[model samples]
Target: MGLNYQLVLWNNHKKTYDKLIVLGMLLYIILFAVVTLVFNSETSIETLVIRAFGSLAIIMLHIILVIGPLARLNSAFLPILYNRRHLGVSMFIAAFIHGGFSMFQFHALGDVNPIYSIFISNMDYGSLTDFPFQVLGFLALLILFVMASTSHDFFLGNLSAKTWKRLHMMVYAAYALIIAHVFLGAFQQETSPFTIGILVFGFILVSSLHLITAFKEGHIDTAKTEEKEGWLKVCDISEIEEDRAKIFTVEKERIAIFKYDGKLSAIHNVCKHQGGPLGEGKIIDGCITCPWHGYQYLPANGQSPPPFTEKVATYELKLDGKTVYINPKAFEEGTEVNPCKI
Candidate 1:
């Protein structure tokens, strides 16, 4: 929503979101430390700190991964998606803390460089039980570092939306590495059923949500609609709620047909920023507001309001006895099409 590159301004909602994040992280870490000390009185302080932060990071990563699919499945989850980057950065901090402490505890005492020690400290990669799991964690941390550093709109603009999305998608790789790091490293020594159960539960939850959401999205993408005179028939006007949208996939593009002020307009569903699902958003302040980042565009022209230059392709919509029809051919970005009155 900014015309120039500058530090992102924190709104009241963002401030509250960040406060919750900090509070939750602090609470989790404290509770972890206390629980570990009570359960295993002989555990060292260094080990407690390492495990606390490491476990917190793992939990945060799970929450982060679940947010996207959850949002897609139900719009009620979109509020969390608004400031997900904050959670991501916080997760990286926890991970860095864990990795840093572990490096210092296990490798810093050796004559070789600490990072070098992670590789040379363990050469038994052939054995599943004695593999160099820290190396996997290190690589994952590096990927996370890249993502967290470039999480701002400045980087998104410079790298382009596609490139930025692809880069951030490295999260799945990082997740795999972290999973391996946990199983091959900690699980090798700790064989508690509760720990293993938690890991398995998290993995299953993340995987299942993703699969279900993917299937839903795929079905929508491949759905068939009646086409007449180069126009595709969508649902009736009553299907869409006021200020909401019903998305249709046409010509390999997802188009959002929004209902507001007793009128209908169609625009590219993909948000110009971060490629968010604009169809999932609602009308706010008379503009179509992207649920992901609050990016707003005029339904009449697919253009952002004055002082903003972002735009999306528009489509011509027609009303035939309460049924809506859309031309698959898209107009140029920011092209104004007269709305179809209800």
Candidate 2:
């Protein structure tokens, strides 16, 4: 929403969200340290800080990963999704602290550079139990640092949304590296069954949530479409929720048919901002809003309001009894078309 670069477009909501996150993170660290002290009185402060921050980072990463799929599964999770960037940046900070402290405690006094030592000191790649797991964590931290550094809208605009999204998608690779780091490092040393069970349960829960969301969307994409001449049947009028859209795949192209104000309109399902799934968003202020970044387009025409040049292809829609149908052929981007009356 800026012509040039912007560090951040902060608002009251973002301030409140950030404050709550910081408070929660501090509380979690304090509680974890207290519990560790009670259980093992001889545990050193450095070890406690390492474990506390490492656990917090992993927990934050899990929350960040789940927010997307959870929001897609239910609209109530949208607020969490909206402020996910903050959570990601916070996670990187926690991880940085853990990494810094570990390096100081274990490798700083050595002859070689600590950063270099992280890689050269751990050469047991052939053995799973003896592998240099610190290297995995270092690489993952590097990726997270990159992502957090370029998380602003300025980066998104300058790098182009497509490139930015692809770069950010490296988080999945980072997550895998972190999982291996934990399993090969901490889990190998921790003998508590409770800790092992929790790790396994978290992995299964995150994996299942992602799989369920993917399958649900896949079913929608594979839905049968009835075509007559140039128009393709979308769905019954009653099936579409008010102010919301029902997405359809017509001839390999995805279209979003929205029912609002007792009328129907169709637009390309992809948002120009980040290729976000526009169909999943709801109508706000009489404009079709994108779920990913809140970009908007008028329903009657696929163009954004003045000062914003974004646009999408508009499709011709028709109503027959209670059924809604859309022309398979899309008009040129920003083309104006009348909304079909319900």
Candidate 3:
């Protein structure tokens, strides 16, 4: 939420979040190194460092993937979702360290380039046990690097929210590749069944959470309303909580009818910042605040406050006794639609 972009808008919240991330990462790496040394005194420092960072990256990625669905399931997790990009960039750093050391340790002394050697040196793709899994890891790292490089709002603004979101959605692909890399490469060499089982559990957890959240939200997309006099009947006024919203899908567009300050106003459910579900958010300081990033907009006009240029489409709302109805058509972005009195 800024009129102009600098490197970072370091507020107290961001500063605190980043500090926690750094401390957590450092603590994990140190604990990993210490535990590995205590258990396996024969393990070389190089191998230990690579494994520590690689494990950290894997854990960070799991956390990153889980945060979205967790937030969807419960609003208490929204605080964690606020600064996820910082965690993403930090995860990339750990992954880069792991990949860099791995490349050097395994292929640097070869006659050809290390990256080239990763492919040519491991041509046993035909063998499942001896497949070239490093290639998968390298590809995943490349995708992460791309995402990390463009994590800033400058790129988000330039690329447009939709395009930026699509680009970042490549994290799922990267996750799949990393899973293959771990199972085919590291797990093949490891003897511990418990370690492999933990990875399986993580995969199941992430997948199950996403599936559950999606299934829960699926009804909202498929929801249909009765039309009366060119207005779609949304729901009983009692269904909408004060300072909250009830989202309705109209003509393939999701409209959020907010109940605040003893009146009802309808606006596009999609937040301009990152396409977050505004319907999931609450009215804060008389503005509809996005749950994802706290981008605020006036409930009456669907416009961000002064000095902010973001806007969302406003829809007409009407009240018939205790029932709420909304016009199927939407006004232009930033159009002021008078709120329906309760």
| Index of the highest-TM-score prediction | 3
The runs of at least 3 residues in candidate 1 whose Cα sits more than 4 Å from the true structure, single-residue gaps closed, are 109-111
TM-score of 1: 0.92
Clashes of each: 0, 0, 0
* 86-143: candidate 1 lDDT, tens digit per residue: 9999999999999999999999978999999999988998998889999999999999
Q: Which of 1 and 2 is ahead in lDDT?
A: 1
Model 1 per-residue lDDT at 199: 86
Deviation from native of the Cα of residue 70 in model 1, angstroms: 2.0
lDDT of 2 by residue, 1-342 (tens): 545664576789889999988998999999998898899889999999999999899988888898889998997888888888899999999999998899898889999999999989879989999999999999999999999999887787788777988999999999999999999999999868887777778888889999999998898889987888877888889999999999999777789999999989999998877778889988999999998779999998999887888899999999989989888889999999999997
Clashing pairs in 3: none
Alpha-carbon TM-score of each model against the true structure:
0.92, 0.91, 0.95
Ten-residue region with minimum lDDT total, candidate 2? 1-10
Query: What would you estimate as the lDDT of candidate 2?
Result: 0.89
Model 2 clashing-pair count:
0
User: Which stretches in model 3 have alpha-carbon errors above 4 Å?
Assistant: none
**lDDT tens string, model 3, 236-288?**
99999999999888877888899988999999999988889999989999999
